[model samples]
Target: MSTNPQKVHFIAVGGAVMHNLALALAKKGYQVTGSDDEIYDPAKSRLENAGILPQNIGWDESKITDDLDAVILGMHARKDNPELLKAQEKGIKIYSFPEYVYEQSKEKQRIVIAGSHGKTSITSIILHVLKYYNRNFDYLVGAQIEGFDLMVKLTDDAPTIIIEGDEYLSSALEMKSKFLFYHPHIALFSGIAWDHFNVFPKFEDYVKAFEELAEGMPKAGAIVFDETDNMVDVICEKERADVAKLPYGAHPYEVKDGVSYLITEKGKVPLKIFGEHNMKNLHGAKKVLERLAITEDMFYEAIQTFSGAAKRLEKLGSNAHTQIYRDFAHAPSKVEATTKAGKELQPDRELIACYELHTYSSLNKDFLPHYADKLNAADKAAVFYSPHTLEIKKMPAISAEEIKKAFGREDIEVFTQKEELENYLKAQNWYESNLLLMSSGTFGGSDLNKLTEMVLALPTNKKEKAKPAAKKGSVLGKLFKKKS
Candidate 1:
């Protein structure tokens, strides 16, 4: 390591990824300094503990020195940010989050998982399997997996870097999609769906970004994609002949008594996570790992203990009769998949799916039609959207009737107030039922832990008798005991 490590500054360090990047760089012996208009914990505590927390909250143009090696810009920082201007004036090289990641891992084999939905899950699975066998690798996962301490890992010695590549914009300065910069040697295209309406307004416009990513693939690079997805199939089929096309679909699995197990020649491998979507994710990950020297047997062995990526159908609380899940499923495709997965997990149990139309796209009346039949899988469905949220986003107000009609479920309940929604959920008969809460935003700032506790404490319907508990020596009973 050099005596004077390379200096880098962050314009908006409060961001989840930006703060983690700053911390990682600091741990790598870099002189890290950053500023943001507002700082929040645990980023605040982590940065302060590292002795790199800015003296003041807002940006300081004086901190931008000509000697700084680079300036890593975050999406939170605007084009007119003073710190960015100062860095530009000083000719300090600027890099977006993806750009900096690529700069660091340019020499390594970059295996990027690109998609609108399953990118995080597939990336997390690959990372979990690689780490289980002690494979030398760096990674950038979207959400925190249990074994990993941080979402992003950059190391000089790792031969490969697995990145959860999002199709969203890199930064305000860079209008291009983030995944376009990775130039992955082994790319996994999960599936494409229309999202980020503020960025790519039209479905075709959104698809074009992914098309560009596929067209730019280097020769001999392997592209593992979902053959079931028509858009992905078209993109991969049209790619240059030199780039190898590897297609995969959902792995075969069976669900019995509320548990999903993968069927193998040797035996059935029980999984902590369940769903057809997840099975596809697992298969996609397996294909990517096979190219990296992970055997089919090895992947199955390691994946059994793999729970799931955080907030991607993550279990919040579970009892004998009821389970509550919190998913980051703001988009139409994500909501549908997650809702269906919840029902599949417990076929006999009633599924009460509650969704929050919180994102800019989901709130817009023009985009409401995209959610048609999305929540039909659930036995009961409820959609909540804050009028205040619409006001904040400067979007037109959407009526409850529009939401019900858009979902193609006339009987579906819609709520504007979080309190009323919470009350409705509290009033539900949780006996032999599972609840799925799908949203990107907090349900009107509701504390989910408290909400879950209240729901769990609610009494079952007096009309129906409770079903007999699972046998003490049964597989389900054993699993529950182990979890406890």
Candidate 2:
């Protein structure tokens, strides 16, 4: 540690990403201190363990000292926050989360993964593969990947940094999208879909965020985009001569006996993850890795061991005939893709897909129509939203009939009460059926872990155990299988 370490203060440190960044900076030998009005578990405990938890909650103007190196602000901190006022009075440098992130990594080669969906998965894949090779790299991903301790990392030694660029507001003081601050040397635009209705009220305003990102690429920067998404394709088509445009689609793969495999030049490479969306994410990761000099063989070998990023088709528990999965999918595009992925994974099973309207866009009456038929792939579909959430968001009330009409499925179940939703799910026949729960927030504070256990223990109608399918190849055939 340096004798005079950088002194950084967090105005509001209890946020998911804010707390994680605090931990990361503390670990990097910075003198980190923070305060929040209310600190919850995980963040509270982690900060306590690090010996940096504030002795008291709420902002303190005295904590904002003249000698402070920087003040990092979280979105939770209002513009009129006491500490914020002090920092401004002292003329101390203040940075929004994304601005601070860019400041720390500006000297390194930045690879930012940006999209409406699959940003976390793509970023996780790149981090996992890079870690597998024992390469020196830093990353900032949203979800908790399996091998990583924190969701954010910053260091002085790493030559490159990978960032999961979100299209959300940076902070209260800065309303610009977080991705705008990244200014990546290499970037991937996975796809575009209208979301965050509270932030970008107009659909064109949402698209314009990506348009600005594409328009601002530095000379010699590269962007790997998904051509399958017409919106993404059209945006990338407006050419910038200095920026190289790379396009990728879903990779070739086949599923047999409840397992998905990638057809590669080295042979049939089995994967722990499935679904076409994941395959597309895998191919996108491969394209990004190619630019980093990771060959196809290396990428395939490293990817085989990666299960998935947390909450992206994450399996909770599974029985022979029943499997329970939970995903963080709230937007229309994500809902459709995740639902289709679940159905495609187990085409033979009855898919009972349940979605919770949690985001501002999902709860908006106008935005409800975009979700039309998104749940159509499910054998039985259900939608749940807490009326209380609408009250907190100050949105107008919507009825069950309105929801049903918007979905274009009269038979689809809609529940405003958590107990009613749980009861409805508990009443289902679990025999050979798969349960998929999709939400960005908890289903009105449902204990999903306990629910998963209950669903897994539910009775199935199969009288005898099913036999495992025989493999088409022998051990020698597996060894000599050719890569595509």
- RMSD of every prediction: 7.8, 8.5
Instruction: Please estimate how well model 2 matches the true structure, expressed as its whole-model Cα lDDT.
Output: 0.90
- Judge candidate 1 against the unseen true structure and give its global Cα lDDT, from 0 to 1: 0.88
Summarize candidate 2's per-residue lDDT along 172-232 as a digit string, tens digits.
8899999999999998999998889889998799999999999988899998999999999
Compose the digit string of candidate 1's lDDT tens values, residues 287-372. Answer: 99999999989999999999998889999898877899999999988999999999999888888899999998899887777787
> How many angstroms is residue 253 displaced in model 2 relative to the true structure, after the best TM-score fit?
1.1
Give the lDDT of residue 13 in candidate 2.
94
Clashes of each: 0, 9
On the 0 to 100 scale, the lDDT of residue 458 in model 2 is 75
lDDT of 1 at 464: 62
